[model samples]
Target: MSPEDRPAGSGPQAALPGCYRHPGTETGVSCTRCERPICPQCMVTASVGFQCPECVGRGHTGARRATTRFGGVPVADGALVTRLLILANLLVWVLAAYVFTPQLDRVWSLYSVGLHRNGPEGVAEGPDQWYRLLTATFLHVEWWHIGTNMLALLVLGPALEEALGRLRFLGLYLLAGLGGSTLGFLIDGDWLNSRGASGAIFGLIGATVVLQLRTKGPLGPVLALLVFNAIVTYSRRDAIDWRAHLGGLLLGALVAVGLMYAPRERRGLVQGLTVVAALAVEAGMLAIGMGLYGG
Candidate 1:
């Protein structure tokens, strides 16, 4: 009813029903949901009844839900490990590029080393030199080099980390890097010093392919990209470490396959064993390469 139609005495002092908000005025109407006295300004028309604004807001807040694209388990932002990995690579780059001398680069770059001789770069030849296998993945000599590698990591790492927990994802990266180093040591001329995270980045790519295959998703795009990258790697023989890329791709695919096919009950055991087996294979290959080089 219009204010003019209501009795003038329908004010706070009068004996009349009043809205909670419009305490000085009267309203016979009540919120259908909460049964609170409300005036026309405060009332919201529902399908069959009137509801208060606060009640509608509470309903909306409680009713909202989210789901992942694949309709699998709800997606989570598991990017902590990815960020830490990038930070580590950047920290090493900063130290090598600015804080330390060229000596640091020489120490970190992966080159052929064995029991009998230091690499062509004249890095000290010892069992300790094996560290270069892993360390090289974290070092970069130029801005473009590091930038590209880190961009790939930023794109790929979080997704893989979410698919595989932080530990396994870390294992995949390190092992792929080591696999690349091992292949470089075996095949590349002893004179060439190789460094960068391309191997690990390629591993992520390889894992993406395997992930797609395992999920029975479309493989055309991933496969085409892999082929294109491989072509580029081969074409730039002077600039690219194709051996590292190939090694990482093959090893990463193997790891992904192992992860996909592993039994759910024994998944952890299988992963640990796979990691151990990979390390053993690398060690054996290194031993054989040392023997061949010495001879």
Candidate 2:
């Protein structure tokens, strides 16, 4: 009955609508889009008025996802790539330690030429053996050697992976290893064998330092680490291939500069070219070394 015709105290009043999502809870407010009753918890503020949870979800479905600073897609697990790389390295080490023979060592180790008592054998001996340039980076001489190299990789890989993204980080790592092997082959005696991930680890170090400087992060810790490594390399020069470490460091720093400082308009093109140019430089060094060795 109309209020004017009803008694002063009404016998019954209209019941409030229950929230659509929460059937038991009463709410006066309704979603602007769907016109369904919504509780405060289900309301999502909108441009014109409040929206329900379902409406908000549908609206965002077509929106663009966020990207990282270097144009890589943001990943939920930033360290996934780093962890996989570590696993690969460990697995290779296990194979090298248990299944490999002296002959297999020659197959994987980086050497442009090695002089045996009977004859010469190594990468320069044939084009097919050039794979040694890359494979050598994954080889380790002893328990202590792999232990130290893996430890360094674990320490440095994750942060760089997060900064550079998976593809770029992987590219930097591989190229740095190649640079190290190439430079060591160029400068060291032809008979010397070089194998280890030190070059790649040093590359990460160099890149880390560059990134810290560009971002204006606290630089003292990274600088100190660099200094300590330099001292160790020099003091153990007889046992270490300092040339490889130096080569990797220089290449990594150059790559990082290009990646981090490229013009926003031409970032992708510049970064790709920088990586290609670095690779070309390594190839040129290899050619010059081969010629010098009379290979």
Candidate 3:
């Protein structure tokens, strides 16, 4: 008799199993671990064979996630924080340039004495305006000024952020900027106004050198860049606040050393203490600046 006419028990079967996760799909493949039917969409590659999503997830439950060298969670997009910082600087520039104009300078720029055609006004002259030290870092008027600083930030920020992780990198930037501001305030004449992200950018340059040293990477290019910038800073000392650059560079290097060389057993504690100490130093610098400005 023909095969079609054969009885059910005597005929060959042609049916396939449906996937457990997707019942509507037919699949001949099974999960290696669970031996459950799974479609291509539900398959995760394994050493021996393909596994189902559930099996893969179960295997990962006891495994530790990867982290960066400085105890930061590794990120796929390393430049995220850097981009945000650049955007913030750009936005502040836009506001100071068009929306706020000269008014922003009087209110937010870092200066001990305010001497204007109208009258005397400034950060030191006002009560509780210490925040100007930070706010001024984001203020810029000249196109070339902001352009150069932002370009440097775009270049150095991502790598540092990748090495130190988002939070630590951000703290480094803010603290370095504050260090620059405090030193500039202390050194610059009372009438001189200081504003720009150059200090923070200098800090990034400093941190980059430290990171290269810690990782045992080549130092030629970084050192060349540092030397070039140092020369430029000195050359333009008439216009630039070299003290801010020096302060930022020093603080950034110190912070990077703390972050990179902390004992593995007490890494977080040491890092926290380092940051606190840095802040205390900045506070002390601010007090000295105030003393001189008052005198």
Candidate 4:
């Protein structure tokens, strides 16, 4: 190839000046970096000459993606933890409805009565009944109960999980449920059986609202929704455990505050400890409720 025929950025490999991708197609332009002959289609305009798309992509391969202020990796899809929680609740609800008459609810539901209930013989009871704290969040009697809770979860879980991440969100949910159960069992003395995911759902709401507040995002919508739900809960006092909802909401908000205020270098540790502390508080509450720790 003549020297005059060589492009400004041409290298020895592009001496003949045929497109590397298309041997028959002549390309006067060469990649500004790699200096490979590139056809018009392969050329990516640059400040100097032109670069190949491959070279441009290679240049960016080492670059890290942008993350959220809370250090969460940005996601394009919905929350996996939320979906899994919904699925588990649905499966448990189905089994409770079909496979196990009323037995599942009786065993899993949180009752105001003691762990050792004065009920029919052969019924499962004792310390193991303590599992009701978490299990009750999964068990729902009425379809509307599950439907409302699931819908609220569908709305709230993704946003909260996006802010807190999967593991922390999971911890928030469980601790919220435990907190709700502990408070309900201690306070709601007249109510016999209480079971629903509303407490956990309320926790998700609280987390979302607090996250929005921490990020300085709009909080009107979330606060309004919370107020409306609280009103609805109070209106249905005959049926709903609003006390549990309140407890879970407060606990979730406190956890979110701790998470948001934690040092950036030790955020994960602080988050984990925050959840553990919440659990410890719930445990203490339960022991007190059960008269085990000098209550």
List model 4 lDDT by residue over 34-101, tens digit each. 99999998898988999999899998897966654555666675499899999999999998987896
Measured with C-alpha atoms, the lDDT of residue 40 in candidate 2 is 92
Give the Cα error of residue 266 in candidate 4, in Å.
2.6
Over the stretch 26-58, how does candidate 2's per-residue lDDT look in tens digits? 898999999999999899999988999998899
Worst 10 residues of 3 by lDDT: 114-123
Order of candidate numbers by TM-score, starting with the best:
3, 2, 4, 1
Residue 88 in candidate 2, Cα distance off native in Å = 1.5
Top-scoring candidate (lDDT): 3
- lDDT score for residue 280 of model 2: 94
lDDT of 4 at 267: 72
Q: Between the candidate structures 1 and 3, which one is better when assessed by lDDT?
A: 3
TM-score of predicted model 3?
0.77
lDDT by residue (88-205, candidate 1, tens digit) is 9999998889888687798788866433455323222446566888899999878888998898889888877777766778888988888887777777535558899988888888
How close to the true structure is residue 6 of candidate 4, measured as C-alpha lDDT?
81
- Each model's lDDT comes to 0.76, 0.80, 0.84, 0.79
Could you tally the backbone clashes for each prediction? 0, 0, 0, 0
lDDT of 4: 0.79
Q: Residue 84's C-alpha lDDT in candidate 2?
A: 82
